[model samples]
Target: MSIWICRACGAHSESRSGPPPKCSICDDERQFVPEGGQEWIARETLASTHSNDWTELEPNLISIGVSPAIGIGQRALLVLSSHGNVLWDCVPVLDRKTRDRILELGGIKAICLSHPHFYTGMVEWSEALGGVPILLPQADLVYVTRTSEHIRPWLGDRYEVLPGITLHRLGGHFEGSCVLEWEAGAEQNGALLVGDTIQVVPAKGWVSFMYSFPNLIPLPAREVRRIASRVADIRFDRIYGAWKEKVISSKARESVARSAERYIRRLES
Candidate 1:
């Protein structure tokens, strides 16, 4: 038995067999446990609530897409690589169609998350991908509701999901926040798959560049510089933020540098 997030109530439940037994507090109208009755989601059962529609986002660097949770607030990115495919972040939803699509794109090799909030369907996803390794930052392991042999707790400033793909933790939103630097994003340099760690404000045209997109709170100039410094070491030509327009097509490094300086100047001034 593992902890599963209730789609309706958003509460973590120690799921053992046959749907969540009416989500303790909320009732059926609120959530539906998986049919197997033995379906397990996370290692911790106390965790609750989840969203469906693990809606797959678009893929390009290697035929990947963002798995979306309609009402819930979270995002998952799918990355297809020859060595093995990886799903970055994670939405609350997961279904057969998406599974079929994942199979078509090549079964997932691993799922690396940026933080705990995005760890929604982690266990379910890991199981769906034939026990694909779910790489988590050791620091955030406390939030893991579902414990699995498949869950590989790793520590450090960065993690290698697969060949040409690396997960770099540049603390921001969460202590273990990370961004993916994919060598395969393109042949030239690479692409940074940043969930919301460094948001792309499509509405602003410029990358929103924030500590927290949800809160609209800005990071200190020092923090901004740190993020920029961490990312600067990596060779990337583009930055993929979490939306349609959250990408910077201009000189990638230069763009980050400018954004960093601008943030610092504004904060200081």
Candidate 2:
């Protein structure tokens, strides 16, 4: 058996003979199958050609992404903490060099996900790093195609990964969509790792909420308000989105609030 990855979404599927007929994640309403139809790539092939690139987002936070951009092109954050390091999101490709560098940085204590869209190769990631636990939202468990012993399902609106690292559920993009609030980040002002749950839009100092990004579908006004209200009390100076360079540098809380207001107004209009 081999792990087949969807070319469009970077979601992993286990197949005994060949790649699955179609990627369920891509067939879903939120995502789309490419014009060429669903395509699959073997993990070994991906590892041979692609490699992960690293960038220091802040003092203790590092961003890792696959160079040449495969499978949604999302970057994962390696959050270094005294308690242990936490991988905030996951990418499709994980090679020897990437694993070695992470091992040098104390390995991963836990693998946390924002939603199912970025659940690519999570089981692989956990197994590679000492079988660390993969924390996923229970509500979105249906979207998980691949399974492993290390996968842990979490419920409710709030979860504490560590003493100061918290996961807050703000259900807009997905029923169990969550964000990581690192209290020690942003030079102690705090940082929120939101994987398109509240997207940092192209507009400067602003963010947006959506039910479907590629399909251009919008979330309900109430849902947007609920998402805004969920993070209203959290203290965060910086907000990191899934893609590289997608961030609200500062005043992120205020930006989210006003952005929510704007989204609501436009929907009502």
Candidate 3:
């Protein structure tokens, strides 16, 4: 038996003789199965062809992504702090080189995911790093496909995973969709490691909230407002999106407010 990973969404499944009949995560309304149909890959297969690529986005933040674009093509952000390193999101492929590099820069102390879409190979990652605790929102616990002892389900609107790094649930994409507020990031101006909960649009200094990004489904106006309101008081100067180069470097707090107002206005119109 081998741990199978969904090719479409990168979610891991239990050890099995072969690929599961279907992928629940991709079959859901928010995600979709490709026209080519559902597919699965073994952990060893992924390691053979793909490799982890690391880039330093800032002094204490590192962007880790997979080459050849495994799964949903999302990159994980490694936030370094005096307390410990926290992996904001996760990728499907983890190889020996990547594991060694992470160890050199101080092994991960905790792993917190923004949502289920990025839950790819999280258990494997935690095991590789000597059983780091995986902090997931309690509301989204149902989405976890592969169970592990390292998984820690947290409740409520906010959780301080570390001393200065906090996870704030905004609830746009999923019930437990959250963002990491690095209080000491962006040169003390603060930074937000936001996944798809609040999407950074192509236009600079702008973001959008959605229920389904790939399906083009818009979130309710009230829900969008609520998400914005949740982070209204959090002072953050930078906003990092799920993909590479999608960032609001400065005035990110204002960007969220402005974007929310714009989204609401368009809805009312």
TM-score per prediction, in order, is 0.75, 0.99, 0.98
Measure candidate 3: CA RMSD. Answer: 0.9
lDDT against the true structure, per candidate, is 0.65, 0.92, 0.92
lDDT (Cα) of model 1: 0.65
TM-score of 3: 0.98
lDDT per residue (tens digit) for residues 1-269 in model 2: 79998989999999999999988899999999999998999988888889989999889999999988998999999999999999999999888898999999899988999989999989999988889999988999899979888989998999999888999989888998999999999899999999999899888999999999999999999999888888899999999999887988889999999999999999999
Off by over 4 Å in 2: none
Number of clashing residue pairs in every model?
A: 23, 0, 0
Put down candidate 1 lDDT per residue, 1-269, tens digits, no spaces. 55555553233455557455444423322233345442334434322332234333334443223333332344566777678788887755566667777888788888887656566667777787688888888887766655678988788998877878999988776677888888867454687788777766544434535554444677777888888889789988777665445677646667777767877888899
Candidate 1: RMSD over Cα atoms? Answer: 7.2
In terms of lDDT, model 2 sits at: 0.92
Local accuracy of candidate 3 as per-residue lDDT tens digits, 146-213 = 89999999889999989989999988899999999999999999999999888999998999998999
* Cα lDDT for residue 8, candidate 3: 91
